[model samples]
Each structure stands twice: as C-alpha cells, then as structure tokens.
Target chain A: MKPIIEITDLYFSYDNKNLAINNLNLIIYEKEWVAILGHNGSGKSTLAKLLIGLLEPLRGTIKVNDKILSQETVYDIRRETGIVFQNPDNQFVGSTVADDIAFGMENQQISREEMKKRIDKYIKKVRMEAYLQHEPHLLSGGQKQRVAIAGALAMDTKVLVFDEATSMLDPQGREDINTLIQELKNDGDKTIISITHDIKEAMLADRVVVMKEGTVVATGKPTEILKDETLMKDCGLDVPLTVKLSQELKKYNIINDIYVNQEDLVKSLWEYSLIK
Target chain B: MGIQFDKVNYLYARGTSQEKAALIDIDLNIDLNDFIAIIGHTGSGKSTLIQHMNAILQPTSGVVKILDKTIIGGRKNRDINIVRKRVGLVFQFPEYQLFEETVEKDIMFGPLNFGVTKEESAIKAREALKWVGLDQDLLQRSPLNLSGGQMRRVAIAGILAMEPDVLVLDEPIAGLDPQGQKEMMEMFYNLHVNQQKTIILVTHDMNYVAQYANRIIVLNEGRIGFDGNTWDLFANYELIKKYHLDLPDITKLIIDIENKLGIELDHKINTVENLAQALVQALGGANHVR
Candidate 1:
C-alpha cells in the first residue's frame, strides 16, 4: 500500500509552554479509513487541523502525495485535502445547498459548466438533489452535514477529514452520517480520516489509532484496540456495550473469547450455549 | 410539590403564514423527587415541554401548575421569575452562555440576579462548585481558559447556584467525550439521590434511560407516544420503531440472540452483568459451563 499522507516527529503547541501534539508520527495509506480516537484535550483535533494546513506545526514535517507541507506548498496541500468541522451551522459559507457545493470548486478555477455538472452529480450522490435550492439554515443538522460532505467531495480532493463531525447531531442523524461513511468506505477510492471519541464510529473504520495526552497510545484494527479494556480505560474511554458483555461472559467461563462487535459476540454466545 | 401540565399546546410564529404547532394537547404530572427521562427525536416537542416547566414559555391553550403557582394559557401571569427560580432549565450547549470573567462570578450570576446579597451568593457559588466537582482554585480563572469539559461543569454550577428544586437539562452530555459523559451522568444521578432534587433530562440516548432513570416519557410529533418504566417501553418494539427510538444495547443483543438461536431470553436485562447472568441460565445454569 502506498502512503497517501506521512508525518514525522510532528510537534505543535497552542501556548509556548504546552505541547498539544508531542513528537507524533503517523502514516495513512491511500484509500484507508482511519479513526483517530481520543478524549477531550487529547490533541486529535489539533492533528486534523495540522494536516490541512490550518495550523503550522512548531517542528517536524507533513508530507502529502510525496510533497512536504510548508508556507510555499500550503495552498497546494489544502487543495488536495478537505475537512468537515464539528458544527455544521458554523461551516456554511453559501446561502443555498447548491451554492455551497459549488463554492470549493469555484475557488479551484473550474469552469461554470464543469462546476454545475460536478455539483449536480455530488449533490445527488449525497441524496440531496431535492434540496438544491434550500437555504442551509432551514435544513436539519443531518441534512446540513450531508450538504457539507457533498461540498467537500465535489472539490475532488484526494483526502477527506471529519473532525468530530457527528458528535453534535441527534442519534438518528449520527447514524445517518455513519451510514454515509460506510458507503464511502465501500467505494474504496478516497482516504478518509475521522477524529472522534465514539467507539461505535471507530468500529467502522479500517484502522483505529488511539491517542492520549498528546501522543499515540495504540494503533491497530478496531477489534484489537477496542478489546483491551485496560487500554481503553487508560485513554479515558469506556469499551462498547458488546465488549463489556463479552468480558463479563468470559469471567463466568461461559465464553472463552472476546468479541468487539454485537453480531459476532451474539453469534458466539449462541454457539457456546448449544454445547451439550 | 411538583409540576403539572394540563392540555398544553404551544404554537410558534403565531398568526403568520408560517405559524405551526410545536406542541399539542398534553397532560403530565411530575411529582417531587422524580427522576424522569424525556426522550424523542429532534423536533419532537421535548424542548417545548421542558420550557413550560420553568414558565419560560406559556401554553397556548392550557395550564401549567408548578407547586402552588399556576400559569393559564392566554392569561397574564405574574412572578414568572419565581417559577424560574424553583425550576432551573439548563439549555443545550449552555457553556456558550458563560460570559463572566471569572468562574466564580459566572456561578454567582444567577443567584445575584435573584436578589441574593453578594456575600451570600459567593457562598452559594462555592457550594455549587463543589457539587460540580470543579477545583476551587478555578474560581479566579477565566471561564474561557478552562478545558471543554471544565467549562461545561462551570456552566452547570451556575444553574445549581440558584438553589432550584427541579433541574431540567437539555442534552447535557451531547458534545462531551465518553468519560466526560459518564462523569456528568453520575453527577446528575447523585444529585437526584443525595440531594433529592428532581431531574428532568431530555436526551436521545436510550442507554441512559435504561440505566439511570426510573420513569421515561417519549414524545412523538408533539404527543405522548409512550410513558412508562424502561422495561415496558423496550418491550413494545413497534412503538419504539414508530417513534424512531433505539433499544438499549444490551436489550437489543438479547433480542437478537433469542431470534437467531430460537431460544427464550428475558427482555428486561439492562446491564452487562444481568445479561450475562441470563445467558448463563439459558444455557441450563452454571453447571453447563466448563
């Protein structure tokens, strides 16, 4: 797998005294969906901003598509990356849905005809074609997020970052965005990075990176990282319900395994119960 | 004493083309020391219903009774602030409302506005800070300088300073991380248990409903779709689906096992230990396991 984005010895601090991102090193491969999991003030969101050139790192380097990030190449780097913020209401720059989707492409110097075609195609892809003319403020939180995603994808960026994108939405809205993320993963073309504290959302990603206190604590497949209850606790996260149940069952010798997802755990328990 | 709502209906943008009903005919009685979880999807009238608890919004065609005070629809009501003082309603994202330069001043703001002396309000502020589990050293620091979780607690401390009998929280744990969410939930549960404070929490997360609350009220399109204990609500799968409600994770897992394995399992299991015990029994007791 070719590395799409690479970081080396990265360091950043909001104040001169405190290092928000402390000697962090990471590499995300092409077409990979990586979930950066952390508690509040753990510096996961700061890393997202650093990747998109929104914040300059105090030390080290970030390489995107084999090019290092710097003042000279910041614009070029930003053009290749797109990010969706936590609050949908604060991200809107256009009055209408269609206009919002076209705003990024317009900055890219795309022609009117091509911009219209891309907006039409991407808006429909997000299932918001009917809301082409609706003002963003009139839309629901979930709908506004979909429009924001459509805008990001319409720009044809190679990487997309969601910075706590679903945290503020209602449960149903959060589920809808998760479904969209699942669909995007199946397409297997864009590199996706989701910064969140939700274990359920992290379970859907191809890889999970757990951060604590401005550093990487663990990196592995979702099941490997999530099954370690001690590690999750150390990082200030409670394991998901299924994992908790699996651990309890293991304690009773009712089952000899730990299952991360609900389906697998339920199936294994059923099989175990059938033992005569 | 507690709050009572009678045939309450609320309309937004009244007398205009865009005028619409945000709440419909509703009747509810909240008793003293009740820990109620109000749940529904967005725009399900949960906020509108809670607003009536504090007289922030009056009913359009009904009545709201809080303790001995009564607010009749379309009629002039005096001393609305009295109801506000007793029933503290914490809005969603309340941290945004913190404006005082110091955390102490922010906590004292609510009490000071209600005619408490500065010295007395300062005492209340310190006590409320203890309830929120914040360090007293933060009293002199700016509210904006704190972390996100600390900011949220300081904001809640401000409400507690008012010495309200009934606490109404609108998605209090919405943007918090998992650990922060757990801490906030436990804090509220403690307030309900030790302080005997009435907690009316509006949330969409059903897991909290199953674990914390004794009573649950579900709103569907401005009407009471279901009002009962957690077990009964979860047993009615049809109502759960109709109102777009999610089952508690443990209950959902047990139901799935029952369906897929063709076995009988209790539907009332709410915690991991309870579910595991049920599964062990379903396998013909503890002797079945090696």
Candidate 2:
C-alpha cells in the first residue's frame, strides 16, 4: 500500500538551543490507525505539529497523498489533515456545537447548505446530535472533545490527528472518545494518528510507534511493542496492567501466552488451571 | 472533624436563563486523617463539591463547616479566611498557577500569605521541597525553566507548605506520564500515611481509587449515587455502570476470571499484586500450574 504520510530526516527546535525532534523518519499507510506513544517532552506532540504544518520543521520533508508539502502547498496539505488538541476549551471557537462544527467548513468556503448537511452528519457520527444547540461552556469536557472531533471530521480530512485529546477528560469521557475512534476506524477510509501517552489507548491502535527524546525508538503491532517491558520503560512508559499481570503469571509458570485483552487473559488462565 | 457539608446546594448563574444546579442536597462529613476518593463522570458536580471544602465557593442554600468555622449560604462569614487556611485545595493543572521567579519563593508564598513569618516560611518552603523530592539546587532556579514534572512538584510543595489539615486535589495527575503518575500518587500516599493528613482526591482513574483511597464516594448527576469502601463500590456493578464508571483494570480482570471459572474470589483483591496472589491460591497453590 502507498503511504499516506511520509516524513524523512525531520528535525524541530522550539528554541535555537535544544532540538525537540531529531532525525526522525516515519511512514503511515493509508487507513492506518497509528498511535504515537511517548512521555512528556518526547517530541511526539512536536511531530504531530510538524505533520499538520502547525509548526515548521528545521529540516525535513513531509509528503501527503502524493503531494510534497511546501510553503505553497501547506494550506492544501492542512485541508487534507485536521488535528484535535488536548484541551477542548482551547480549540473550541464557536459558541454552540453546530457553529463549532461549521467553523471548519466555512474556512474551506463550503456552501451553507453543504455545511449544514456535513454538520448534521458528522455530529451524529460522534453521537453528539443531541448537543447540537448546546453551548460549548455547558458541555462536558468529553462532549466538547466530541464536538471538536466533529469539527475535524467536517473538514473532510483523510488523516485526523488527535494530540492527547482525551488526556484532560474523565475516564468515562476517555472511553467515549475511544469508542468514537473505534467507530471511525470501522469506516476504514480515514487515517488516524493519535499522539498520546495512554497505554490502554495506544493498545487499541493498529500500530504503535514509541518515541524517546525526539526519535522513533520502536514501531510495531500494539502487542509487540507493549509486551517488551524494558523497551517500554526505556521510552518512559508503563506496560498495560493486563500485560504486567500476565508477566507475573508467566513468572509463576501459570500462563505462557502474552495477553492484552482482559477476557483473553482470564480465559487462558482458566484453561491453564483446568488442564493442570 | 475535618469538614462537613450540610444540605449544600450550588447553582451556577442562578435566577437566570442559564441557571443550572451543579450540586444538590449534599450532606457529607469528612474526618481527619481520612483518605477519600471522589469518583464521577464529567458534569457530575465533583469540582463544585470540592470547592466548598475550602470556602472557595460557598453553598447557595446550605452551610459548609471547615474545622470550627461555619459558612452559611447567603450570609457573610468573616471567618472564611480562617476556614481557607485549614484546607488547601489544589486545582487541576496546578503548575499553571506558579508565577514566582524562583521555586523556593513560590513555595514560600503560600505560607507567608497564611501569616507565617519570612524566616519560618523559608524554612517551611525548604521542608516542603524536600518532601516533594526536589533537589536543593532547584530552589534558586526559575520555576518556568523547570520541566513539567518538576513544576508540578513545586506547585504541590507550595500547597504542602501551607500545612492545611485537609488537602483537596482535583485530578492531580491528569496529564502526567504513567511513571510520573505513579510517582506523584505515591507521594500523596506517603503524605497521607506519614503526615496523617486528610486527603480528598477527585479523580477519574478507578485504579488510583482502588489502590489508595479507603473510602470511595460516587457522584451521579449532582447526587450521592454511592458512598462506601472500595470493595463495596466495585461489587455494585450496576451502580458503576449507571454512573458511567469503570472498575480498575486488575479488579475487572479478576472478576472476569471468576466468572469464566464459575468460582468465587476474594473481593478484597483490588491491586495487581494482591490479585496475583489470590489467583495463585485459587488455582490450588503456586506449583499447581507448573
């Protein structure tokens, strides 16, 4: 499959002194759900900003959908990609949910009729149709984030980047967005690059990319990346609880299989005890 | 007694078109040296409820008593500042509240405002910094130059310097990494255990609630949905689901194992370490699997 986003030799610096991203190269395939996992100041957010053209890289080339991203094509590239930030209050501009969803469409010079249809369709997609008329201040953090997602989806972007969008929400709110992301993935056309430090959230992705000090350290399937305790620790991350427990069981010679899901782990343990 | 809320009700934008009730009929009593975890979904009045502990937001129709002071709704209380001194409420993202030129001065600011002398406040600042595990070199450095975790520690140290009887925190580890989250939670746990301080934490992480808090309070739609220990809270799956709450990952895994095996396990097993031990026993001892 042709890659959707291609980055080579990416380097970014917040100040003239320290490099935030250093010699990073990544390729995300079409329709792939890629999770970028890292600790704070690991350059994951910097990479996301660089990909969406929010922050210019010191040295790198980013190509999106067969088009090389440059100063001239940056706007066009951004139109094909949308990002949801961590803070819902910081991203929300419109007073109401419908207006917020329409803000993105209006920037693209979409017609009023088309904007209405897109807002209706995308808000429903995020299960926020009931909150269409609600003010942004009144909505919960999760609801505001859902509206933010709707705003991103309304832009018709092929690649959606969530920059720790669920970090500030409650557990239920985080679960809500995770459910929405799964639904979006089921559609199988849009590519998702979620930048987060959440291990459980990262485990749900199709591929996991681990970063440390502004460079890619590991990249593979979720189970492969998360099962390596030392590697995860090197990247300043903790393995999921189930994975940790599975390792404990392995130490006791109870189960040999690496389990990521709760049910799978329990079922394997049950079988192991019954066989014994 | 540490704090009490008697029939408290809070209304946002009261008597207007946008009037909304945030907390309704809250009656709670928090004892000294108690570690309490408040769990709820967003918009469930968790923030509104905690603000009342320190007199940050007075009750609209009830009374809030902190220590020996009583703050009645719709009435002026001259002793509000006295109540505030006894309870230190740390808001979410507290690092953003730091504005001092140096870490030491920032931590000292809280104690000085509470009427501690300059010399005593300076001593308290150093003690607080040491308590939070910050190096002495950071005392002179600007807080803005520190890392996210360091800045968070500085802000938390500022609160600790106040030496309040009740420490209220709102999702104190919201954006921290897994390692930082563990370290910060452990710090608070130590403070609760060693200092014997009343710790009231508002968080969405069930794992933290299970691991740290002995008493759990569940809020649903501005009402007390459930109030009990962690074991009782986990056993009431229907109440948990109705409030859109979740079980700790280890607890959920243990429950799944019990259901699949059609056997009963100890409900007291909340932590991963304890659950692993319980599972070993349930499987007929450690050597049975081998």
User: In terms of DockQ, which candidate is strongest?
Assistant: 1
Q: What are the runs in model 2 whose C-alpha is more than 4 Å off?
A: B17-21, B140-142, B238-244, B286-290
Candidate 1: the clashing residue pairs are: none
Specify the poorest-scoring 10-residue window by lDDT in model 2 chain A.
A255-264
TM-score of each predicted structure versus truth: 0.98, 0.93
Winning candidate number (TM-score): 1
**Native contacts present in each candidate (fraction):** 0.69, 0.64
TM-score (second chain) of model 1: 0.97
TM-score of chain A of each: 0.98, 0.97
Q: Give the per-residue lDDT of model 2 (tens digit) for A1-276.
A: 779999898888988689999999999999999999999989998898888888888988989998888888999999889999998889878888899899988888999999999998998999999989989888888999999999999999999999999998877789899999999999998999999999889989999999999999999999889888899898889888888788787777788877877767888887877876
